[model samples]
Target chain A: MRIALGAVAAVAYAVLLLAPLAVIVYSVSPGAALEIPPSGASLRWYAGLADQPRLISGLFTSLLLGAIATGAALVTGVPAALALTRGSLPGREAFLAVLLSPLSLPGLVLGLGVLTSAAVLANATGIRTAGTLLPLVAAHLLITIPWVVRSVAASLESTDPALEDQARSLGAGPFATLFLVTLPSARAGIVAGAVSAFVISFGNFALSLLLASGRTVTLPVAIYETVDRYQDPTVAAVSTLTIAAAVGAAVLTDRISGPLKTRDSSARSGQPAGPAALEPNR
Target chain B: MDRSRRRVAGLLLLPALLVVAVVAAAPIGLLFRVALYPPGPVAPLTGGPELDSFAGLLGAPYPSVALRTLRLSLLTTVLVTLLGFPVALFLSRSRGLSRRIQTLLIVSPLLMSVVVRAYGWMLILGRQGFVGETLAALSLPRVGLLHTEAAVLLALTESFLPFMILALAASLDRIDPDLLAAARGLGASSARTFFAVVVPLTLPGFVAGASFVLVGSLSAYAIPALLGGSAARTFVMEIYELVTISFDWPTAAAASIVLLLFASALLGGAALLSRRRSARTFGT
Candidate 1:
């Protein structure tokens, strides 16, 4: 009875998650409208991607943007997360909340806020700054900082602080202790955080819509422009590749974060993958 | 000694603090000031600013747009919770290989960018899309949901449901098996065991899951903008339109403040609910 019930649930969930993806992937036909069990199949649409140099360049732009954003997030968010999680700072909870405030604002509001601030600065300083990468990176940093902080904080909170004390007693200085002892413990989380941050920054659409200029189009923005102009399978082909890259990152992160606690009877029953395994990461 | 210790900790945090100040805090502060400092019908900063832009939001088109955004998010949150609960339950109970496979399967959409997922949905929900053809094949009067609010709702639900499921599964995973076994051993039917023991224990997960969907759906821009169409503009879409198309910075800033307030309220409410739940669980 339980097996049957689980089967039913699995099927339902899989169908829900995959229906749109399957239909789109299967229905890509050259010069034909999308249909499930498409009357014909052609990789012509996939081949068509090469014709759009803008999208190819946009893909590179997205990777570069994502990398920059992730680097910024890790550098900034890690120390802050460490301070909040490990240090005996007063009002740390309040500080944590403030740090995470960006997560509470929609990307549109964040984009608008960043844009307004950039304009204000530009006007005040008498500089032309609307189309620069500085604001775009800054805006994405806001979007990704919360993710790195939260994940690193989670790993820190769960770790034994005594280990750090032990490392210090063994004569490791603060910097050495941090690099050798503290960071290694938080490696999985930091990596997971980095991967998710990159995904979040890369997949981001709204902020790019506002912040990206003609010279700086991200993959998401390019997809939107392409789909808007021509409702064809070309967009699907692009989307398919985007999905492939993202899924690869997710699967790779899943492995790097470690396997589910299999072969342990005591830990057997619960969600095989813990919170870190399934975090939206955005 | 205490001051020095505090200073070192502060030093460690300074870089991140500076980044946050410039990135999150300054922008939001600037947004408020810009919104509040609406220029009069003259050169900039000539007259003392008033809350006219905020007052402008109380006008006709704004209210409907605000209402639609909330309505879509609310409906999506509820639907995701309903659909996510069972999958989460099934996921938490199963073991080993099946569990990992199920985990990957459920989160596949989550791996895709919002733009990619939205594009995929556009293909499936369009007039000549699969759903429309399937309905036609069944001889049901042809129905096209794309370019409508329904399409946006479907997209949001799909986008946010994985978050809900993950949260619920995490919470459900923590539920003590002994407690469940006790309920079942007491001659309780499976349904009774589920409700009497499982539901109450999983309430925390349920709340967390609901909060995830609520916040996620509320903050989403891509799903609505991509799937919702021109007429079905969301708060984000409206804000985009306001700044880009209309070139109304002051009003756009004001509108953004309103949307931020709305999103914050949802987060605040979720935080409050979770706090209360934890208090009930832990406090005597």
Candidate 2:
């Protein structure tokens, strides 16, 4: 039974890991035809990406949108994380739940809700918000804030509170103590949160699909449209590039936050560590 | 703890709270209100408030779509859990470099976009793709699986398997080896000890992983749309169609509410189940 289970698991792992690589492999295949094992290797498909105007524009849009959203989330979420961890406020758990509530929402539902809200605002104020970057940024903020809050909060929780108090006692003001003491200690978490926020925003599809106008098309939406219209290797090339970028960011962040993993493990063991606890990109 | 300190904390929290209120909370409230409006041709809320959209959901097609989504999500959850357990077990048992390598293998794909992964499955399962080619090589009739529920299930399972594995691995790592040894020392067989000690201990993780997969699959848009096409119309796809194709925003809002309810119920039920089980296990 154990052997059978192990065999099944091995097959499952291969399928889970190799299927994504199939795209990467196909991207570098020489010909337009997608053969599993290409006759030869070339970067023709990668070069072909340059010819896709929609995809190129979409990539820039997604990058700019992700950057703006990540910046907004960090600016808001880091301070909130600090306050939640160190503020000694009443109803802290309730406040934390409210802040993290967006993580529990389905992207589609949230997207539609925001779309409706934008329509209502436009109707009331005679200024359209849909088909613009405003709604997209708002929706992405909702998605990214919980991640920033959770990551930074988890980091702050591990540090000793006395350090901040000691800094305060040594003539450091509140902001100084926060900047020099609390914020510095939570740098790893801040970096992780920023990466996660950016990645989540960059890869976001359902929300962007609803909120994005024709002019503001994001990469994932563009890829979806391209694949729907034409089954070709260019989409594969675009996907491969994204995969490379995501993996690169993940590795870099993992190296930076390597020491925190050991500390995080003990705190994480007590919880269920659901998708929200991790990064729920979907 | 003092008033001034509390005020500072509130000031710090104001930005996030304001953003959430504007972006998430108000919008959801507006969604519920929109659902109450009668479905109008020109605008969603032109007519007086009525529950017509909610009533429309009880009609044909919506119920069937909801049921299909539920079945698909349930199947995906079961498949992911079954596939995740042994892998999680293997991960929990491994150490050092091997563990890190295995972890990377499991998590790297997760970092990739869902669209990319779904597109990969599309290539593999398309008519001129790997599966069809393999069938041709075997002298068998080529069958197109790209637009089938099975293909969507495969992609969804693959997409969510990492989450299940991670959740289960977290719980499996927490299992006290001493408890397992105690069970074995008490003359329990290996299988007996696993069932008696390990399974119960991992139940919380199982619940967490199961809820995530279930909710995720229930609301999954890209995978089902790409793989299942018209054959497997999920609830989210139905909602999408209602908004974009049908131009029926009220019905779409009502449908979104229904999907939200379904997700909330699953999550709430899982939370209750986990709490009860933990309370019993820990004797709290």
Candidate 3:
């Protein structure tokens, strides 16, 4: 009964995730080529995407924005994580909340806030910040940094703070202690956080839409424009690419994080776990 | 080792804090400030009344838009939470590779662009989309799912389901297996054991997931704009058009203020509900 249940669940999930993409793939049915199930398939739409300069440029812009935002997030998030966890700073809990508050704040409100501020600056000083790549990067950084902070913070929680103290007592400076003792222990978390941040910035569309203009469109916004204007298989091709990246990153992260431990053992092991791994009884 | 290091750490956080202030807080503060002012484009910066925007927003189209937003958000919250509960429960019951697959399946949506996901549903639910064709095949009356409240609801549910599932799964995992066993050993059926044992303990997850989904959907623009069509509008869609297309910054800011207030109120309600659930669970 359990096996049957599991099998059913798996198939349901597979269909839920794959069926939509399959629909798009099937739409590309060419007149002369072999057809896919549920309908015919064609390569013409796939060929058409190659000529969409906006789509191509949008892809480049998205990649660049993700790279910049993720890079900024790592730099900022890593230090914040270190200070919050390792340091004996006063009001550590308060600082942590402030860092993580972005997780709770609605992105729509945040985007509007940023836009409003840019408008104010332009109004006051004749300085325009809207529809620029910089604003897009900044907006994404606002949303993406929290993931790294949480990931690094979780990793830091698992590590023995005593190790840092021991190194300090053994005559290492604060910087050396962090580099030698603390960082090594939380390397997995940091790497995982960076990867997560990269995927997040890459996948982000909301900020890109509000901040991007003609030359600055991201892939998601481009796809949005294309679909809104023309209901064709090109949208499907782009969606397929996105789904592939999202699914691939998720799977890769799971592989990197390794297997879930039994509840008691995982708690005993003191390893920082992701949201999915925290299931009761592991 | 003393104050200097502490100060250094404090100073190190300055850049990040600056980014937050300029990027996050400034915009929010501006939203509130402009919301209180009059609408209809600023007249150069010479000198004008500060509260005109607020008056404009309270008048006419703004109030109606705000009310419509509240109605749509309430519906989206209810639907997402209801659908997510069963899925989250189903996830908590899996193990080994099955659990991994479920987790991947659930979280993968978060990785895809929201716009792309919205677009995917557009193809599926639009007049000429898959759902329409499926209905046609069944020889059923043609059902127009797109450009309706139902369309918005479906897209919101899909976009927010991952959040609910993750939250519920997190909270459910906190349940002690022995408690379930004890319930069963007492001759309780699986269904009773699940309801009496599992649901009570995982209320936190439910609250967390529901709140996240609610806040997310409340401020949602992409799904509504894409699926809901021009006539089927939400507040966020209204705000976006007002600011960008209409170039009505003051009214946009005012609308955003209303959205901000609405979001905070819903979030507060979720918090209170969560606390009450926790207290009740512990009291027993």
Best by TM-score: 2
* Residue A171 miss distance in model 3 (angstroms): 4.4
Order the candidate numbers by lDDT, best to worst: 2, 1, 3
Which one is best on lDDT? 2
Write the number of the candidate with greater TM-score, choosing between 1 and 3: 1
Tens digits of lDDT, candidate 2, B39-127: 74445466668889899889989889888989999999999998899888877777666666666667677778899999989888987
TM-score: which is higher, 2 or 3?
A: 2
Write the number of the candidate with greater lDDT, choosing between 1 and 3: 1
For each candidate, the DockQ is: 0.50, 0.57, 0.39
The better-scoring model by lDDT among 1 and 2 is: 2
The segments of candidate 3 whose C-alpha lies over 4 angstroms from its true place after superposition are: A1-27, A31-39, A123-131, A169-171, A259-282, B2-5, B41-50, B134-142, B181-193, B272-284
Rank by DockQ, descending? 2, 1, 3
Model 2 — interface RMS deviation? Answer: 2.6
For residues A55-153, write the lDDT of model 1, one tens digit per residue: 888888888999999999999889888888777789888888777776656676777777777877888897757877788898888778877887777
State the displacement of the C-alpha of residue B120, model 3, in Å, after optimal TM-score superposition: 1.1
Minimum summed lDDT over a 10-residue window in model 2 chain B is located at B39-48
